[model samples]
Target: MKMLKEKIQKEGIVLSDTVLKVDTFLNHQIDPQLMQEIGKEFAARFKDAGITKIVTIESSGIAPALMTGLILDVPVIFARKRKSLTLSDNLLTATVYSFTKQESNDISVSKDMLHEEDVVLLIDDFLANGQALKGLNDLVKQSGAQVAGAGIVIEKGFQTGGKEIRANGLRVESLAIVESLVNGGVVFAEESVNK
Candidate 1:
Protein backbone atom coordinates (compact mmCIF):
# COMPACT_ATOMS: atom_id res chain seq x y z
CA MET A 1 0.00 0.00 0.00
CA LYS A 2 2.90 2.38 0.64
CA MET A 3 4.21 1.69 -2.82
CA LEU A 4 0.78 2.39 -4.23
CA LYS A 5 0.60 5.70 -2.38
CA GLU A 6 4.02 6.60 -3.72
CA LYS A 7 2.92 5.77 -7.25
CA ILE A 8 -0.15 7.93 -6.86
CA GLN A 9 1.86 10.84 -5.56
CA LYS A 10 4.41 10.55 -8.33
CA GLU A 11 2.16 9.84 -11.30
CA GLY A 12 -1.40 10.77 -10.49
CA ILE A 13 -2.78 13.96 -11.95
CA VAL A 14 -5.24 16.01 -10.04
CA LEU A 15 -7.55 17.26 -12.76
CA SER A 16 -9.97 19.02 -10.50
CA ASP A 17 -11.09 19.31 -6.90
CA THR A 18 -12.86 16.00 -7.35
CA VAL A 19 -10.96 14.17 -10.08
CA LEU A 20 -7.60 12.50 -9.62
CA LYS A 21 -6.49 10.77 -12.80
CA VAL A 22 -4.37 7.66 -12.42
CA ASP A 23 -4.46 6.54 -16.04
CA THR A 24 -0.68 6.29 -16.25
CA PHE A 25 -0.45 3.18 -14.08
CA LEU A 26 -3.93 2.06 -13.22
CA ASN A 27 -6.82 3.14 -15.43
CA HIS A 28 -5.19 2.89 -18.83
CA GLN A 29 -1.60 1.60 -18.80
CA ILE A 30 -1.22 -0.97 -16.03
CA ASP A 31 1.82 -1.94 -13.96
CA PRO A 32 1.74 -5.71 -13.65
CA GLN A 33 4.08 -5.84 -10.67
CA LEU A 34 1.99 -3.33 -8.77
CA MET A 35 -1.16 -5.19 -9.71
CA GLN A 36 0.33 -8.43 -8.44
CA GLU A 37 1.17 -6.74 -5.17
CA ILE A 38 -2.33 -5.34 -4.98
CA GLY A 39 -3.71 -8.82 -5.53
CA LYS A 40 -1.55 -10.13 -2.72
CA GLU A 41 -2.78 -7.40 -0.39
CA PHE A 42 -6.43 -8.03 -1.25
CA ALA A 43 -6.01 -11.78 -0.90
CA ALA A 44 -4.42 -11.28 2.51
CA ARG A 45 -7.18 -8.93 3.63
CA PHE A 46 -9.99 -11.26 2.58
CA LYS A 47 -8.34 -14.63 2.97
CA ASP A 48 -10.36 -15.60 6.02
CA ALA A 49 -13.68 -14.63 4.44
CA GLY A 50 -14.12 -17.92 2.55
CA ILE A 51 -14.43 -16.13 -0.75
CA THR A 52 -15.41 -18.41 -3.61
CA LYS A 53 -15.71 -15.78 -6.36
CA ILE A 54 -14.28 -12.36 -7.15
CA VAL A 55 -16.69 -9.91 -8.82
CA THR A 56 -16.12 -6.61 -10.58
CA ILE A 57 -17.34 -4.46 -13.45
CA GLU A 58 -15.84 -4.85 -16.89
CA SER A 59 -13.02 -2.68 -18.34
CA SER A 60 -11.15 -0.94 -15.52
CA GLY A 61 -11.96 -3.35 -12.74
CA ILE A 62 -10.91 -6.44 -14.70
CA ALA A 63 -7.18 -6.16 -14.12
CA PRO A 64 -7.17 -5.86 -10.35
CA ALA A 65 -10.04 -8.33 -10.02
CA LEU A 66 -8.29 -10.89 -12.20
CA MET A 67 -5.10 -10.52 -10.20
CA THR A 68 -6.98 -10.99 -6.96
CA GLY A 69 -8.73 -14.04 -8.36
CA LEU A 70 -5.40 -15.47 -9.38
CA ILE A 71 -3.92 -14.94 -5.92
CA LEU A 72 -6.99 -16.21 -4.11
CA ASP A 73 -7.37 -19.22 -6.39
CA VAL A 74 -10.94 -18.29 -7.21
CA PRO A 75 -12.76 -17.52 -10.43
CA VAL A 76 -13.38 -13.87 -11.31
CA ILE A 77 -16.65 -12.69 -12.82
CA PHE A 78 -16.92 -9.24 -14.33
CA ALA A 79 -20.22 -7.51 -15.07
CA ARG A 80 -20.47 -6.46 -18.70
CA LYS A 81 -21.53 -2.91 -19.52
CA ARG A 82 -22.68 -3.95 -22.94
CA LYS A 83 -24.31 -7.32 -23.32
CA SER A 84 -22.89 -9.58 -25.98
CA LEU A 85 -24.94 -11.90 -28.21
CA THR A 86 -23.66 -15.00 -26.42
CA LEU A 87 -24.92 -13.85 -23.03
CA SER A 88 -27.48 -16.06 -21.38
CA ASP A 89 -31.15 -15.26 -20.96
CA ASN A 90 -30.93 -15.37 -17.19
CA LEU A 91 -28.76 -12.41 -16.19
CA LEU A 92 -28.27 -10.43 -13.01
CA THR A 93 -28.31 -6.71 -13.79
CA ALA A 94 -27.87 -3.32 -12.12
CA THR A 95 -27.43 0.31 -13.16
CA VAL A 96 -24.11 1.96 -12.29
CA TYR A 97 -23.39 5.63 -12.89
CA SER A 98 -19.81 6.63 -13.43
CA PHE A 99 -19.02 9.96 -11.80
CA THR A 100 -15.89 10.37 -13.88
CA LYS A 101 -17.58 9.49 -17.18
CA GLN A 102 -20.82 11.23 -16.15
CA GLU A 103 -23.01 8.43 -17.49
CA SER A 104 -24.94 5.38 -16.41
CA ASN A 105 -24.31 1.85 -17.61
CA ASP A 106 -26.38 -1.24 -17.14
CA ILE A 107 -23.99 -3.92 -15.94
CA SER A 108 -24.92 -7.55 -16.13
CA VAL A 109 -23.55 -10.90 -15.09
CA SER A 110 -24.50 -14.42 -16.07
CA LYS A 111 -26.64 -16.08 -13.43
CA ASP A 112 -24.80 -19.34 -13.89
CA MET A 113 -21.46 -17.97 -12.74
CA LEU A 114 -22.59 -17.08 -9.24
CA HIS A 115 -24.35 -19.40 -6.80
CA GLU A 116 -26.36 -19.01 -3.61
CA GLU A 117 -23.67 -20.49 -1.42
CA ASP A 118 -20.73 -18.54 -2.82
CA VAL A 119 -18.95 -15.75 -1.00
CA VAL A 120 -18.07 -12.86 -3.35
CA LEU A 121 -15.40 -10.16 -3.07
CA LEU A 122 -15.95 -7.07 -5.20
CA ILE A 123 -12.92 -5.33 -6.72
CA ASP A 124 -12.59 -2.10 -8.70
CA ASP A 125 -9.96 0.33 -9.95
CA PHE A 126 -11.51 3.25 -8.13
CA LEU A 127 -14.32 3.99 -5.72
CA ALA A 128 -15.68 7.49 -6.34
CA ASN A 129 -19.46 7.58 -6.23
CA GLY A 130 -19.86 4.00 -5.00
CA GLN A 131 -22.27 3.29 -7.86
CA ALA A 132 -20.13 0.64 -9.58
CA LEU A 133 -19.32 -1.22 -6.38
CA LYS A 134 -22.93 -1.00 -5.24
CA GLY A 135 -24.16 -2.31 -8.57
CA LEU A 136 -21.80 -5.26 -8.39
CA ASN A 137 -22.86 -5.87 -4.82
CA ASP A 138 -26.50 -5.88 -5.95
CA LEU A 139 -25.73 -8.48 -8.60
CA VAL A 140 -24.08 -10.67 -5.97
CA LYS A 141 -27.10 -10.28 -3.71
CA GLN A 142 -29.41 -11.12 -6.55
CA SER A 143 -27.56 -14.38 -6.92
CA GLY A 144 -28.09 -14.93 -3.16
CA ALA A 145 -24.33 -14.90 -2.63
CA GLN A 146 -22.76 -13.38 0.44
CA VAL A 147 -20.60 -10.29 -0.01
CA ALA A 148 -17.23 -10.78 1.67
CA GLY A 149 -16.08 -7.15 1.05
CA ALA A 150 -14.60 -4.82 -1.57
CA GLY A 151 -11.03 -4.17 -2.69
CA ILE A 152 -10.48 -0.76 -4.25
CA VAL A 153 -7.21 0.31 -5.82
CA ILE A 154 -7.92 3.98 -5.16
CA GLU A 155 -10.71 5.62 -3.25
CA LYS A 156 -11.62 9.31 -3.25
CA GLY A 157 -12.12 9.65 0.48
CA PHE A 158 -13.26 13.24 -0.01
CA GLN A 159 -16.28 11.82 -1.78
CA THR A 160 -19.26 10.12 -0.13
CA GLY A 161 -18.66 6.76 -1.78
CA GLY A 162 -16.43 5.10 0.79
CA LYS A 163 -18.42 6.44 3.72
CA GLU A 164 -21.75 5.38 2.23
CA ILE A 165 -20.51 1.94 1.32
CA ARG A 166 -19.07 1.42 4.81
CA ALA A 167 -22.31 2.67 6.35
CA ASN A 168 -24.14 0.07 4.29
CA GLY A 169 -22.12 -2.57 6.14
CA LEU A 170 -19.62 -3.39 3.39
CA ARG A 171 -16.00 -3.65 4.45
CA VAL A 172 -13.89 -1.59 2.04
CA GLU A 173 -10.11 -1.86 1.73
CA SER A 174 -8.52 0.86 -0.38
CA LEU A 175 -4.81 0.89 -1.21
CA ALA A 176 -4.66 4.66 -1.70
CA ILE A 177 -7.27 6.98 -0.30
CA VAL A 178 -7.10 10.51 -1.68
CA GLU A 179 -8.47 12.82 0.93
CA SER A 180 -8.23 15.86 -1.31
CA LEU A 181 -7.31 16.91 -4.84
CA VAL A 182 -7.28 20.58 -3.96
CA ASN A 183 -5.25 23.05 -6.03
CA GLY A 184 -3.93 20.19 -8.15
CA GLY A 185 -2.45 18.47 -5.11
CA VAL A 186 -3.19 14.94 -3.94
CA VAL A 187 -3.61 14.69 -0.19
CA PHE A 188 -3.90 11.18 1.19
CA ALA A 189 -6.24 10.25 4.01
CA GLU A 190 -3.43 8.84 6.11
CA GLU A 191 -1.52 12.11 5.92
CA SER A 192 -4.60 14.09 6.83
CA VAL A 193 -5.44 11.66 9.61
CA ASN A 194 -2.02 12.04 11.13
CA LYS A 195 -2.25 15.82 10.98
Candidate 2:
Protein backbone atom coordinates (compact mmCIF):
# COMPACT_ATOMS: atom_id res chain seq x y z
CA MET A 1 0.00 0.00 0.00
CA LYS A 2 2.98 2.32 0.25
CA MET A 3 2.86 2.47 -3.53
CA LEU A 4 -0.65 3.92 -3.32
CA LYS A 5 0.31 6.37 -0.60
CA GLU A 6 3.33 7.47 -2.61
CA LYS A 7 1.22 7.95 -5.72
CA ILE A 8 -1.27 10.09 -3.81
CA GLN A 9 1.45 12.13 -2.21
CA LYS A 10 3.16 12.75 -5.53
CA GLU A 11 0.26 13.07 -7.94
CA GLY A 12 -2.96 13.51 -5.96
CA ILE A 13 -4.50 16.97 -6.03
CA VAL A 14 -6.70 18.61 -3.51
CA LEU A 15 -9.69 20.33 -5.02
CA SER A 16 -11.37 21.28 -1.75
CA ASP A 17 -11.43 20.37 1.92
CA THR A 18 -13.24 17.15 1.09
CA VAL A 19 -12.29 16.22 -2.45
CA LEU A 20 -9.01 14.55 -3.31
CA LYS A 21 -8.43 14.42 -7.02
CA VAL A 22 -6.26 11.45 -7.99
CA ASP A 23 -6.75 11.89 -11.71
CA THR A 24 -3.08 11.57 -12.51
CA PHE A 25 -2.57 7.90 -11.64
CA LEU A 26 -5.90 6.59 -10.48
CA ASN A 27 -8.93 8.09 -12.10
CA HIS A 28 -7.46 9.49 -15.29
CA GLN A 29 -3.97 8.56 -16.46
CA ILE A 30 -3.27 4.85 -16.70
CA ASP A 31 -1.08 2.96 -14.23
CA PRO A 32 -1.28 -0.68 -15.20
CA GLN A 33 1.32 -1.87 -12.69
CA LEU A 34 -0.43 -0.25 -9.78
CA MET A 35 -3.81 -1.47 -10.94
CA GLN A 36 -2.50 -5.03 -11.21
CA GLU A 37 -0.97 -4.81 -7.77
CA ILE A 38 -4.27 -3.65 -6.30
CA GLY A 39 -6.05 -6.48 -8.04
CA LYS A 40 -3.56 -9.03 -6.78
CA GLU A 41 -3.87 -7.65 -3.29
CA PHE A 42 -7.65 -7.99 -3.32
CA ALA A 43 -7.40 -11.44 -4.79
CA ALA A 44 -5.01 -12.53 -2.06
CA ARG A 45 -7.27 -11.25 0.70
CA PHE A 46 -10.44 -12.86 -0.61
CA LYS A 47 -8.95 -15.81 -2.41
CA ASP A 48 -10.54 -18.32 -0.08
CA ALA A 49 -13.90 -16.58 0.11
CA GLY A 50 -15.43 -18.31 -2.90
CA ILE A 51 -16.12 -15.13 -4.82
CA THR A 52 -17.82 -16.21 -7.99
CA LYS A 53 -18.08 -12.68 -9.34
CA ILE A 54 -16.55 -9.27 -8.77
CA VAL A 55 -18.88 -6.26 -8.92
CA THR A 56 -18.05 -2.60 -9.29
CA ILE A 57 -19.61 0.62 -10.57
CA GLU A 58 -18.81 2.22 -13.89
CA SER A 59 -15.88 4.37 -15.10
CA SER A 60 -13.25 4.47 -12.37
CA GLY A 61 -13.89 0.95 -11.14
CA ILE A 62 -13.37 -0.68 -14.56
CA ALA A 63 -9.60 -0.98 -14.44
CA PRO A 64 -9.35 -2.47 -10.97
CA ALA A 65 -12.35 -4.67 -11.60
CA LEU A 66 -10.83 -6.22 -14.70
CA MET A 67 -7.50 -6.64 -12.98
CA THR A 68 -9.17 -8.28 -9.99
CA GLY A 69 -11.15 -10.48 -12.31
CA LEU A 70 -7.97 -11.73 -13.87
CA ILE A 71 -6.48 -12.46 -10.49
CA LEU A 72 -9.59 -14.23 -9.28
CA ASP A 73 -10.03 -15.99 -12.58
CA VAL A 74 -13.70 -15.02 -12.49
CA PRO A 75 -15.92 -12.59 -14.32
CA VAL A 76 -16.16 -8.91 -13.43
CA ILE A 77 -19.40 -7.04 -13.86
CA PHE A 78 -19.93 -3.27 -13.73
CA ALA A 79 -23.17 -1.52 -12.92
CA ARG A 80 -23.94 1.08 -15.55
CA LYS A 81 -24.75 4.54 -14.20
CA ARG A 82 -27.02 5.31 -17.14
CA LYS A 83 -29.02 3.16 -19.41
CA SER A 84 -28.34 3.36 -23.11
CA LEU A 85 -30.52 1.90 -25.89
CA THR A 86 -29.05 -1.55 -25.29
CA LEU A 87 -29.80 -1.80 -21.57
CA SER A 88 -32.80 -4.01 -21.11
CA ASP A 89 -35.83 -3.02 -19.04
CA ASN A 90 -35.46 -6.03 -16.77
CA LEU A 91 -32.24 -4.81 -15.19
CA LEU A 92 -31.94 -4.57 -11.42
CA THR A 93 -31.22 -1.08 -10.08
CA ALA A 94 -30.18 0.92 -7.04
CA THR A 95 -29.92 4.70 -6.87
CA VAL A 96 -26.55 6.01 -5.69
CA TYR A 97 -25.88 9.52 -4.42
CA SER A 98 -22.37 10.57 -5.31
CA PHE A 99 -21.21 13.11 -2.74
CA THR A 100 -18.23 14.10 -4.87
CA LYS A 101 -20.39 14.89 -7.88
CA GLN A 102 -23.30 16.07 -5.70
CA GLU A 103 -25.72 14.16 -7.88
CA SER A 104 -27.87 11.06 -7.76
CA ASN A 105 -27.44 8.43 -10.45
CA ASP A 106 -29.04 5.06 -10.92
CA ILE A 107 -26.70 2.04 -11.19
CA SER A 108 -27.95 -1.09 -12.80
CA VAL A 109 -26.94 -4.47 -14.17
CA SER A 110 -28.70 -7.11 -16.24
CA LYS A 111 -30.50 -9.70 -14.13
CA ASP A 112 -28.74 -12.43 -16.04
CA MET A 113 -25.32 -11.20 -14.99
CA LEU A 114 -25.73 -12.08 -11.31
CA HIS A 115 -27.76 -14.81 -9.74
CA GLU A 116 -28.59 -16.47 -6.43
CA GLU A 117 -25.64 -18.80 -6.64
CA ASP A 118 -23.03 -16.09 -6.89
CA VAL A 119 -20.75 -14.99 -4.09
CA VAL A 120 -19.82 -11.39 -4.93
CA LEU A 121 -16.77 -9.32 -4.15
CA LEU A 122 -17.25 -5.59 -4.66
CA ILE A 123 -14.41 -3.21 -5.57
CA ASP A 124 -14.20 0.55 -5.98
CA ASP A 125 -11.50 3.18 -6.32
CA PHE A 126 -12.66 5.21 -3.36
CA LEU A 127 -14.96 4.91 -0.39
CA ALA A 128 -16.07 8.21 1.13
CA ASN A 129 -19.70 8.20 2.29
CA GLY A 130 -20.39 4.56 1.40
CA GLN A 131 -23.24 5.55 -0.94
CA ALA A 132 -21.81 3.82 -3.99
CA LEU A 133 -20.96 0.70 -2.01
CA LYS A 134 -24.44 0.70 -0.48
CA GLY A 135 -26.04 0.81 -3.92
CA LEU A 136 -23.79 -1.97 -5.20
CA ASN A 137 -24.53 -4.03 -2.09
CA ASP A 138 -28.21 -3.52 -2.74
CA LEU A 139 -27.78 -4.90 -6.23
CA VAL A 140 -25.98 -7.92 -4.78
CA LYS A 141 -28.76 -8.49 -2.30
CA GLN A 142 -31.44 -8.15 -4.95
CA SER A 143 -29.76 -10.79 -7.02
CA GLY A 144 -29.79 -13.12 -3.97
CA ALA A 145 -25.99 -13.30 -4.05
CA GLN A 146 -24.00 -13.32 -0.87
CA VAL A 147 -21.61 -10.39 -0.57
CA ALA A 148 -18.24 -11.99 0.19
CA GLY A 149 -16.71 -8.58 0.91
CA ALA A 150 -15.56 -5.27 -0.54
CA GLY A 151 -12.07 -4.06 -1.49
CA ILE A 152 -11.37 -0.38 -1.93
CA VAL A 153 -8.29 1.31 -3.35
CA ILE A 154 -8.46 4.38 -1.15
CA GLU A 155 -10.56 4.91 1.94
CA LYS A 156 -11.08 8.17 3.79
CA GLY A 157 -10.45 6.93 7.33
CA PHE A 158 -11.67 10.16 8.90
CA GLN A 159 -15.02 9.68 7.20
CA THR A 160 -17.93 7.68 8.59
CA GLY A 161 -18.46 5.50 5.54
CA GLY A 162 -15.79 2.93 6.32
CA LYS A 163 -16.98 2.62 9.90
CA GLU A 164 -20.61 2.38 8.85
CA ILE A 165 -19.94 -0.36 6.35
CA ARG A 166 -17.76 -2.32 8.76
CA ALA A 167 -20.48 -1.91 11.38
CA ASN A 168 -22.80 -3.78 9.05
CA GLY A 169 -20.58 -6.89 9.50
CA LEU A 170 -19.24 -7.14 5.99
CA ARG A 171 -15.54 -7.69 5.33
CA VAL A 172 -13.99 -4.45 4.09
CA GLU A 173 -10.42 -3.99 2.86
CA SER A 174 -8.68 -0.78 1.87
CA LEU A 175 -5.22 -0.50 0.39
CA ALA A 176 -4.50 3.07 1.42
CA ILE A 177 -6.49 4.95 4.01
CA VAL A 178 -6.06 8.71 4.30
CA GLU A 179 -6.48 9.99 7.82
CA SER A 180 -6.14 13.59 6.71
CA LEU A 181 -4.84 15.70 3.85
CA VAL A 182 -4.13 18.85 5.82
CA ASN A 183 -2.17 21.82 4.50
CA GLY A 184 -1.48 20.15 1.18
CA GLY A 185 0.18 17.18 2.89
CA VAL A 186 -1.12 13.63 2.91
CA VAL A 187 -1.49 11.81 6.21
CA PHE A 188 -2.01 8.10 6.26
CA ALA A 189 -3.76 6.14 8.97
CA GLU A 190 -1.13 4.91 11.38
CA GLU A 191 -2.66 1.58 12.29
CA SER A 192 -4.12 0.79 8.90
CA VAL A 193 -3.96 -2.83 7.76
CA ASN A 194 -4.03 -3.67 4.07
CA LYS A 195 -5.79 -7.03 4.39
Q: Which pairs, if any, clash in model 1? A: none
lDDT of 1 by residue, 2-104 (tens): 8899999999988889988889888899998999999999999899999999999878888999999999999999899978999977899999887667898
CA RMSD of all predictions: 1.9, 1.1
TM-score of each: 0.96, 0.96
What is the Cα-based TM-score of model 2? 0.96
How well does candidate 1 score on lDDT at residue 82? 72
Highest-TM-score candidate: 2
lDDT tens per residue, model 2, 1-195: 778888898889877666799988779886999999989989998999999999999899989989999989999999999897987898989999987788999999999999999999999999988999999999889989999999999998878898999899988999898888777767888644444
| Candidate 1's TM-score | 0.96
* Model 2 error, position 104 (Å): 0.5
lDDT of 1: 0.89
